[model samples]
Target: ARPCKIVEMSTSKTGKHGHAKVHMVGIDLFTGKKYEDICPSTHNMDVPNVKRVDYQLCNISEDGFLSLLLENGDMREDIKVPEDPSLANEIRSRFDNGDDMLLTVLAAMGDEAVIALKFNTK
Candidate 1:
């Protein structure tokens, strides 16, 4: 199965010589692209192993990527900054003010990205 979030789904009745079909419309969680497919109602589907972890933004690279310190104290520099313009500005501003930032990292099937950022007290 693709790493997408279901946006809509529908089922159609089976015709005289047809099997029932389930149609799903989804959006790729990482890329924000649309995906649609139809399959038999009995078809087994795969689900990606998505994990969310909270980390602290420890450093910002010259290229704008982030260095996040995980709960275990390990630093991750692999995930790039979010592509959303507004969120990126928010992160940049928050990081500049020496704020305690809580960064939520999302990972699935070895693919990871920064999904959320927020200021924290303490």
Candidate 2:
């Protein structure tokens, strides 16, 4: 699942280089667990760790699709199935029909860039 929204972000100067550098500390929406890491120097952006979580969530979504197919007795013996088979179509339909507000929330949290970074990392 996608993580809850970032409730807060705090920064602290790490050191005095030729220019000042800072690190970011953030808390998740539900757990409120705090995590600290360095920001990208050039952009002051969080160093794309959010993408890792998003990729994991995408894997979980795929697994959920597989589980659904298995439960519905729709999985084929062949691993190489067509991209838009019935199961795939059903999954896509459900995913598209469902108004998953969390997705929008994640997108607001810069998930698009994170997802792009995840693909590049792979």
Candidate 3:
């Protein structure tokens, strides 16, 4: 299951013979897509385990793979720049200008992506 950020959630009062209903609107964390669901208030929903890590941007390959420096002095290359052209261009431009960059990567359900970037403070 993909991880989503709940944009809106509300509960409707129960009727005489029915359980309360919950209406939820969520945006996919990785894809920027919207999803809506209505369920009984008593129902259990599956929540994906999501992790975020900040990595030092070291290099970007020609085909878009990112070379990130791990905290423990290791390099990881599985994630790529985000699909948004503006973000990708900003990342590349900053790196090309020799600015130290820190990239925030979000991982969930075996999927990972670079979600944000900022200058490295150190």
Candidate 4:
């Protein structure tokens, strides 16, 4: 992971029949690595309402939240240990569905929001 800052955001109608979309560009504040991603629509409000600085902080918070969740002992019980085949399949299916939804939302973020996220490696 690298520390980064959102430098710019832009949105445009994806296609005549498709929904609007947001594109974000970020620069690594520490190492100067740059990145770009399309934000889904659901994240649209996350950017503009929060602004660039706030958005970066929020991303850090989110990453922390995920890390904490993964570290918590309770999460170990949330899934079958030793990886039950059936349970693993079900979990994978659910994750795939969620990923699709996330992609859809990300692709729909309009220009007003800062869709870029910066992360620092531990």
Which of candidates 2 and 4 is the stronger one according to lDDT? 4
Global lDDT of model 4: 0.37
TM-score for all predictions? 0.91, 0.25, 0.94, 0.31
Q: Deviation in angstroms for 113 in model 4?
A: 28
Q: Give the residue spans of candidate 1 off by over 4 A.
A: none
Tens-place lDDT digits, model 3, residues 3-115: 89999999999989999999999999989999999999999999889999999999999999999999999999988888978899999999999999999998988889888
For candidate 2, lDDT tens digit of each residue in 41-109?
Answer: 556343333432222112114333221123244532212211335534543454456422111112324
**Model 2: lDDT of residue 80:** 21
- In model 4, the Cα lDDT at residue 21 comes to 81
In order, the Cα lDDT scores of the candidates are 0.85, 0.35, 0.92, 0.37
Model 1 residue 63 lDDT score: 95
Model 1 lDDT tens row, 23-53: 9999988878999999988898888889998
Q: In model 3, where do residues sit more than 4 Å from their true spots?
A: none
What are the RMSDs of all candidates, in order? Answer: 1.4, 13.3, 1.0, 16.7
What local lDDT score does residue 86 receive in model 1, on the 0 to 100 scale? 79
The TM-score that candidate 2 achieves is 0.25
Clashes of each: 0, 0, 0, 7
Candidate 2 lDDT: 0.35
Candidate number of the best TM-score: 3
